[model samples]
Target: MYQYTDFDRHFVRQRAAQYRDQLERHLRGELGTDEFRALRLQNGWYIQRHAPMLRVAVPYGELSARQLRQLAHIARTYDRQPDGPFAGQGGYGHFTTRQNLQYNWIPLVDSATVMELLADVDMHGIQTSGNCIRNITSDAFAGIAPDEIVDPRPYAEILRQWSTLHPEFAHLPRKFKIAISGALEDRAAIGWHDIGLQLKRDDAGHIGFQVFVGGGMGRTPIPGIEISPFVAWDHILVFIEAVVRVYNLAGRRDNLYKARIKILVKAEGQKFVDAVNEEYRRILADDPAGHEQLIPQAELDRVKASFVDPAGVKAEPAVTLDDGDPAFARWLARNVHGHRLSGYRAVTLSLKRVGIAPGDMSADVMDTAAALAERFSHGELRVSHRQNLVLPWVREADLAELFQAARAAGFATPNAGLLTDQIACPGGDFCALANARSLPLAAEIAERYQDVDELVDLGEIDLHISGCINSCGHHHSGHIGILGVDKDGAEWYQLTLGGSDGSTLSGTTTPGKVIGPSFAADEIADAIEAVLNTYQRDRLSGERFIDAVKRLGLDPFKTAANAVRVSTAKAPA
Candidate 1:
């Protein structure tokens, strides 16, 4: 994790102070509601269905244990529903797929205090919401992945600093997202981002990026086009700026649905590419500060130096554990992952337990996670894009002890990458944008697959659920995607088959095909079960769920899903 310097600390505090003044003005009615809306959104505040929701940025998914501890304190202290279904309860925080944390019940009046608390730990909500560059995300195993071509943290950090308060592209046509990947696999889901950067090396061993433009999911699901095969590391920032500038100038603003860069790219095709390239050419040739925009080797080195191994982390001899406990073996197989270093293993602490909303963490669990990071991972933690916590530097020698402690703390479910380890959003329960609920369905499915043997037999499946069309839950990229819909004022779910996030198992980044008409909320779980049954019945030996889906296509799954729909009609309340 990058340690915050005095400048970074001062910058965050200043932003927090400014937010306090703005919030005070808004509260006193000195600032109009319409005028305060943009200001609040810029500071990561939003008025949800019930109360204010604050999204705190976790830059590149990295967090020190101390920072996490402070987050737990905020959850315990400020995230409360004074008079609602959750009145007496507090201490809830959600981890989003974009690698940020959201507090749903935070009062708008107390938001400035929350901002100040975030600043105390070098964290804030800047650009987390609004039509600006959001958090810069990357692979959860960014620096530790064994198959990494280059460490992307330095480049991600550089992009973060460049885009943070960028005067030029802050107010684009829509919210812009950027993801980078340095590993052989596309764990970051970069192709689904507004700007996707895959760090690579040329034949001569010079680091550069394979830039993809205009990939996003919403009403339209499109994979990004490869705008450039390689943008040299020094010019990557300028190249991206050119792409954003082109979109900003040409992207639609009349219709909210068509305002995304993807729409612009899809509509213009080659013309979009031509315009971006022309802009890039002008930036390098015509602009006075073009040469100054090039990244210096010294600056790159300075950022890279901050990403070194956490202090006190040293290599230890690898040990083979032949534990007789099947549960322990299952946890090892599922949660533990390979690390670049010989003795270190990255372990995912499962957050998808039944009855609990996926990604929702209470203060107790947060504290336990912080303690686990300190004891096992050198006090460094990572928030995975899959909505789970990661101990990125855990020692292989401490596997058994850590697993035991984690299980005791409800973090060890041994279901990582399995059917029960689902990715879901806070749907109708909290989000005002959602048309239906996602948490109930996610919990029902998780409860149905509690049998560990059954979950393992089903194999690793990317089951994603979204409450609405926003794609915040990344439903379009799941092997099995469930999108909530409103049918005749009743909650319904649309099932999709054969989506891929471009992982080793999923092949490439592609949107899933819808499996006919939507099912009522009550029927969705059974419908999903039907699809899984079809896969189990027809799959070749050792074939993963995604592979079977690709081989058989969507017809079989569609038929199975539709077969489970109830014949009797239920009127909407």
Candidate 2:
């Protein structure tokens, strides 16, 4: 975890104060809606379909217990409960795919108060939204992953500081996202970000990055191209600056839809690479030795030192699990991940509990999770890109006790990588940009697949649902992807198969392909069941859903899904 320096604290506090003043002016009508819109967006305030949404940055998905406590407090103090059975409980904060926290019902007037609260914990909403470099994300298990070539947090922090309030790139043609992964497994979905950096080692044992540019999902889903095979660690910042500069200058501004760097890269192709290389050369020529080199030796040492492994921690020798409770065994199998340390294991606290919206947690649950993290994980926790909380340093010996505690706290749900552990964005219910509601559909799917035995039989599956083509839910990366769309006045869903976030560690990636025509929202679950049935029938021994789909193609699943739809339509009402 990167600690904020005195200067960093001072900067955030000052920015909060500035925003407070701006917000007050807007409320007083001194500033018009149009004038305040840009300022509010830059500060992470969005007027959604229902109420204003505030996205608080959780840099590199890391949070201290103290910071988590502050977030819990914010949820209780500022957010409002919806009208439902869950009402009267404190506001439920939504964890997003970007590893940030979103409160959907925050009042517009309290936006500055939220910023102040965040700044108190050395956090802020700066550059979290708007046409700026968004939160710099990395592998959730960056430092502790056994196969990681380098811990990406130090570099992510470097980029965070460099990109924060960058005047030249703040108002670019479109918003930008960057992800870095040191693990061979692309847990951070590096291929789908605007600029993805995968750490690699050379023959001389020098660390560099394999840079991918322009990969994104939306109306146009394209995997990033390898822009640079090997960029030295020291030159990464400069290289990124060069790439952004090229995009800033040449990316389209005429149409909002075509403004992203992906569009620019699509249009220019190899010429785009040439332009970036030329820019990189010019930047280096001008600043042979300057502050533009964000990661100097001293800075690297400082940042790395802050993230040192937990002191005096020892490995628990060869512990055996309690096989008496089948439920505990299931939770262990699904929620626990191997850690680099001998005794420690990374535990994912599933936010995908049935009946609850994916990634939504009430303030009380947040507090309980914080307490659990403090007690078990060295007072530190991480938010995964999959929209779940991670206790990165849980001891294997304590798994049973932790499981008990988690069950009481509503965090133990024996489904981490299963179909029920779906990733979905706040759709028409919350997001003004959405064409249809996604939470209800996700809930329906989760309810339909509550059978633990069935899920285990189904094997590992990545099911993602997005509200619209923006792909906020990362539908294009799921094994079974669902995208919500508007057809006439009805909400329809388009299904895709064989997409993955590269979790297989195979060093190759592919986006999902659409299976067939869109289905009505009501018919999606049955259609999904039909696809799964086809997969079960056609799959070779030991093949996963994605592997089976790829080997057998989408035709079989498509045929099965359509048959189900047709049969259901013809049934007597």
Candidate 3:
């Protein structure tokens, strides 16, 4: 929400003009594919399955309604080129499992124009799609959640600026993700982020963060280690610099597969981690405090004010969604959430529609959302790490109309917290980084379970799938986890149970076991059914699937899952 100062404005314009020239060269054949790949990534462009995909940074999932509107306009204008861009191939833009928007199937030569278009709106594509620091993500329910100890956005914004195009940290050994969640609940999936921070108010009445290090999912699954219990707000950026500095120097650079910070954290113990951070902090302390001194106290305050009205946006008395149409009542039950605003709500766009790929949205859809964001919401929209869109501020009275518009645009999926509402990465089908196909398996699990009544009866559960060990899909923290692995040249799934996403996050209770190969989506669904059945009959009353698995141990579930030999004991007829 921080207004772009003239300095910031001028800087972004310069960056955009620079990228435009690079794009022109890439198209003119002056830049080879390899060279262009690196440059395009730095500017948030990627060559995906269909066409070119442009990734727009959401900056830790924060957006101004105006910004959201602009994004929508770009999608509608660019993706749907009159008779539609690229004919039938291009439709919706993709909202990622992280905090960014991906518009795929873009014509290679025309992308520079798109970059210029975005720059006109006070935005840029820098570092968004790169191996550098991708979009800095935070808990979706950050400040507004009732249980938060302190708001963490001001800190996030500060880091957002410092990390943007910092020449020293741009190209690392591998990709890095960082998450900061203030809520007692870990909505940001922080456990899976490379660097996770939980904001807390110290006993001395100072706002600080509990720093977590390592913690990622890839070929190897590792949980974050809480390296420091109290890192004051002022030192947050400096501390991060230290961590990345160490990784940049020692993290594996020879093999792309083992290059992630996760491996480095694994190679070194927590004590060694502390020493690295301390050493860098001391060196930085000796300096004349360059960037820190440049950051004005007013900057933080300005960003704070940009946040959607924390005390409610409307002048009227509170009106809950239950007071309106039955549809709103249903949406509120699923997509809508309580905000710090007394009479306002943060509405979630559920990604769990039955047959559709959970997070797929056409470019036109993105445009529609931008229009609605302009007219109804605060001109801001946020993409949740769960792969859902969020309109963070809506007056209780406008709920019905807003719901109608979203439903028309195919944004209505009333299963935000339900079991079918899942998190999945682009598997072998889309991502070059994948070891196994994940989307088909996810679709299979989602469609196989047809009973809504049964799901409600079972209560809320977190189910996650990842194509490979890379924890991009957050497989490590799922109540029920399915990781795709390769064996004998065939794609296989590794099922894990009892992963937690809280402050004291836990890993899969037992080592994940490989499920059958090339199992259709339907069979995967049955596999889940079998796991649930084990929990249903054996679980103590009031115990959820995760708790039951934790209490009874993974052996029971393992035995029960292996019992379903893929051919028989199916989920549905």
TM-score of each: 0.97, 0.97, 0.88
Error of 1 at 62 (Å): 0.2
Better of 1 and 3 by lDDT: 1
Candidate 2 C-alpha lDDT tens digits along 147-257 = 888899998898898899999998999999999999877799988889999999999999899999998999988888999999999899899999999999999999988
RMSD of each: 1.8, 2.1, 4.0
Predicted candidate 3, C-alpha RMSD = 4.0
Candidate 1 residue 426 C-alpha distance from true site, Å: 0.4
Taking all chains together, the TM-score of candidate 3 against the true structure is 0.88
**Candidate 3 on 1-573: residue-level lDDT in tens?**
556778888887787788778878877889888987888788888886656778887777877656655665666566643332224534556667787777765676777777777777777778776567767788777766766777777778788888888898888888878888887777776766788888888888987888887877666767778778887776677778888888888889899878888788888887558776776667567765645533456766777776646333554678744535655565677788887767677788776666566676655565677677666665767778778878776787888888888888767666776788898877777667677887777777777665666666666777888887766677777788887766656676667777766633333222233433334343455667888988889988887766687789877777777666556433221
CA lDDT of every candidate: 0.90, 0.88, 0.72
Top lDDT model? 1
Q: Ten consecutive residues with minimal summed lDDT in candidate 2?
A: 564-573
Off by over 4 Å in 1: 82-89, 287-290, 568-573
Runs with alpha carbons beyond 4 Å of true place in candidate 3: 80-90, 288-296, 308-316, 320-330, 400-409, 487-491, 503-522, 566-573
